[model samples]
Target: MSKPLFAILLGLSATGALAQTVPPPQIQVTATGIAKTSPDRVTVAYQVRGEGTTSDEATAKARDSAKAIRTGAEGLLRGDMELHASDFDIAPVRSRECNRDGYGQAQLSTGPCAILGYVVTMPVSIDTPRIADAGTLAGLIGRLGGLQVGVRGYWLSDDRPARQQAMRTALASAKAQAQLIAEGSGARLGRLLRVDDGTNRDMAIVVTGARARVTPPPPPPPAAPPIQIDLSPAPIRTNVNVTVVYAIDQ
Candidate 1:
């Protein structure tokens, strides 16, 4: 199920009012914390199109172009760089033969049919430990094709670690709030009832290519081992909400 925009759960005890025939006491509140860090990885995906008179020609051209990108990016991409054909299409470009009826599929004879080129795509993921070197990679990719430039996807580094740290801190803060609220009301808080993690999502930044989507190898000045997109650390977040019940020491 999709994560809710907000969540609230509460636990209470009847000892304070059940015997005396008074209403049970209840309370509610929410807490939040946010942190930011530089992204450690980037994902890039883009397409390459090639048109020819025949389907085979278009397909071949597209395949060839995609391969070229992969080759160019061989030494520039991270270890986990993925270079594969995303998609392909080969069809005739036709203007429907005018008929008495309105627009319909054009059943024209194959005399000099123009072929619509296939758009081949290549998607790549990079582990950018050195965030600063991104510009260098960009320059290399921008010139991958004659002139066509690709897109980029940048995300935080060591995401799981970051999120875990953030969640722990957030949860602690929440519990502190709960404890404070309970104490101010002269109630001794008991064990935690439950907790709900906040909305969880992965925002995938897109990456483009000069000719097609290309994940290049790490840059030449090999500062560290070939970068690998160990996605386990790319800025992931986990939220937690806990409900605690307190026994009123009457």
Candidate 2:
């Protein structure tokens, strides 16, 4: 037999009575802080590529290019500027030919595909605290030929200090606002109830416009002066926001 409607309502009322409660009054404030710091280092990456009918030939060409690049940047290799070269990678260039079968389906040749040539590639990186030298180095790499240059980033090596400063600023703002709200409502601000940290740590400064053609060209004449490209990197900015909840004593 089903229960009576009054009995069901009484049971529900009992359950609700057991779970009833009241929360204390509180004030919540969200504040943001921004801090800027000069970039202390810059990293640049460049690729050296060579193509030849044989693997050995391709490797030799790529090595030659790498040597040329090192020699060109020799002057900048000292005093906080360092170069890092990764291992070379060699891959085959392939070609395929196919014909139509009797069923009108495409059928590839039974034998192995022919290799047109081999390509060798080497990746090199430059790390320097002298941010102003980035542009000059890029120009030199472009003129040296057989390379494509890229800028990794302009960064602050250690951003903990900046993050701490921003957090302090945010906390101060949040506390001040909370106190103001409590006083205006005829209540005293009590202890801190909760704090939510919402700082974004994945900040990166990106730079572009440092690429060279794949085809290598002859070096310029002795009379021609080197090209200069100035890239003044802007300061790195860090922003942090925090949500704070404070108890109220009425």
Candidate 3:
């Protein structure tokens, strides 16, 4: 081919290649912000476990403990606070001959699970928004049934307010960041094109009940009422994520 014709063919090929490689959909940036705020409510789960040779015996024991827990907990939770049943379970004590962790050889109960003996457990949730004395309630729960006891965690009182504030803060920060980036790159930032709200699972701060043994039986001490240790909410950190879409100006 002539030199001129060859040059024209190469130019067309280059242009075709450039057109095929379209620029990526716009650049999108996301940012997150966290806000530390006072908790609005307090929630804690109290567990009571019981065991007996027969299913009826175990169930009765659990019922008694649950009634006691509810009695003590009813007035403790605030008006707006809610009460939810945790879980009920029955497990058998295993002998070494049967299994190391559980009684694998023992006759199974008439259920879907491998249950030997009856193990009844109940959990009561306490909301501290309206309750006046938290320490008092704790002491009351500590004395119930004298069995294994545990507390899950205390979450932020109200979740909505903190989440909203965090989202606003994150969006503002993202916009500022995007604008700066666009300006420095010789481009203009456009209107927001998208938004996303993130969910949160509270991370626990304190965990109780990990001891192998308990205090020895108390001597004949004063039969004073249970020990109540009132508590107040602590500062909680909440976070929010935001994605902002801005048109890229040429």
Candidate 4:
């Protein structure tokens, strides 16, 4: 054979050997696991809003109401009960007025617009392990004028254990799925090649049992009725997703 023909034959042989050394195929699968449990803690929120002709007056009024609430809440605080001020804000209140034109075309003009007054708001939060006292606290705050109450039900204080449990279940699920796929394709799963931690989402929902809004009536009743606060038991859901890649036996 000529030299050129011999060289071409050798190149084809090398290419065939390289092709025979290709790696086996891989299978990947993803799975999610969810765990739910009742929350172990409760939190209640209160707001005090004051409106006055001046910013200082409005802020002073708001501060007074907040102090009263803090004092009252202190009395209700037990070993597990916690009370603290969360937020405060003050802003000017605005009003708008319009008048018709002489041509009777109803062309309105800015009549009398000014900063009528100032408004102030303060927010307080209470966290307690004693779930039953939520109602009593709400009633107490309701009786105090210029205060609004909102209740938030159960939330897990710590989520580490729950997350670990979810991760274990997620891995098992992924393995099972990968095994199933391998069996369907008439092959056995060899070993784990890769792992990816997918989305891990945790959410807690607070069920509000009661909301109290006190508005002074023209002739307010001799006394306000007792406010009933109920916090239903709500569960927190923890979810974990994982993607696993396994090698296929040749």
TM-score of each: 0.57, 0.68, 0.60, 0.67
Ranking by TM-score: 2, 4, 3, 1
| Among all candidates shown, the one with the greatest lDDT | 2
Estimate the TM-score for candidate 3.
Answer: 0.60
RMSD after Cα superposition, model 1: 13.8
lDDT by residue (16-65, candidate 1, tens digit) is: 34557863454444555445555666554455656666666767776676
> For candidate 3, lDDT tens digit of each residue in 1-250?
6999999999999999998898633547799978888755555567777788787888898888876765555544423346677677876654433454444454543443344566777766766554335556666667765243433445665566677777778988988888888888888787777766544444333456877644333233224555656566567888887777777767
Clash counts for all predictions: 25, 0, 7, 0
When 1 and 2 are scored with TM-score, the better candidate is 2
Clashing pairs in 3: 41-157, 90-119, 135-228, 135-229, 135-230, 136-228, 190-247
What RMSD, rounded to one decimal, does every model reach? 13.8, 10.5, 11.2, 9.6
Taken over the whole model, the C-alpha lDDT of each candidate is 0.50, 0.77, 0.65, 0.72
Identify the runs in model 4 with alpha carbons over 4 angstroms from their true place. 1-23, 79-86, 92-117, 146-148, 152-154, 199-228
Better of 2 and 4 by TM-score: 2
Which scores higher on lDDT, 3 or 4? 4
Error of 1 at 107 (Å): 3.2
**Local distance difference test, candidate 4:** 0.72
In model 2, the clashing pairs are none
Model 2, 126-179: lDDT tens digits are 887878778877777777763668777899888877877787888999999999
